[model samples]
Target: MTGKIVWAAWHPRHGFEIPHFYDGAVAFADIDDAVRLVRTLNADDKTNNRNGWRAVKTILVRAP
Candidate 1:
């Protein structure tokens, strides 16, 4: 069974944005988990003052 692939972006002083051009992303078997991660990252960034951003998107890939 194949799992779903999610894409997210992290930027300075940004919350969430399009995954395009972003090489960094987080993946999860469940969409809920992916969302949770985004929220977690956002909250973590707030305290760390790293000025980070986090976003999530689902991507479709064809099997080779």
Candidate 2:
């Protein structure tokens, strides 16, 4: 753990029960790991598919 309580990331709208793939239901412990996951997820996704089959779709959201 980073030992610093911080922000959390989850897909409630997408129906994610708990945080998957990342360390926990929290922001990445390290910047590198977060970046890696982003790249991997993008690679796994197909064009125009977004969160399609075989793609682990996790989104980064900003307050609206």
1-64: candidate 2 lDDT, tens digit per residue: 1245322322324332233454434355455564454455445543222342122334345545
Off by over 4 Å in 1: 1-24, 47-55, 60-64
TM-score of each: 0.40, 0.34
Q: Which candidate leads in TM-score?
A: 1
* Residue 44 accuracy (lDDT) in model 2: 52
Error of 2 at 59 (Å): 16
Error in Å for residue 53 of model 1: 4.0
The candidate 1 region of ten consecutive residues with least summed lDDT is 13-22
lDDT of 1 by residue, 1-64 (tens): 4645655444554444424434444455566675566666657556332445444465645556
Task: Note the clash tally of each candidate.
Answer: 1, 0
Candidate 2 residue 54 Cα shift, in angstroms, is 18
Model 1 lDDT, full chain set = 0.52
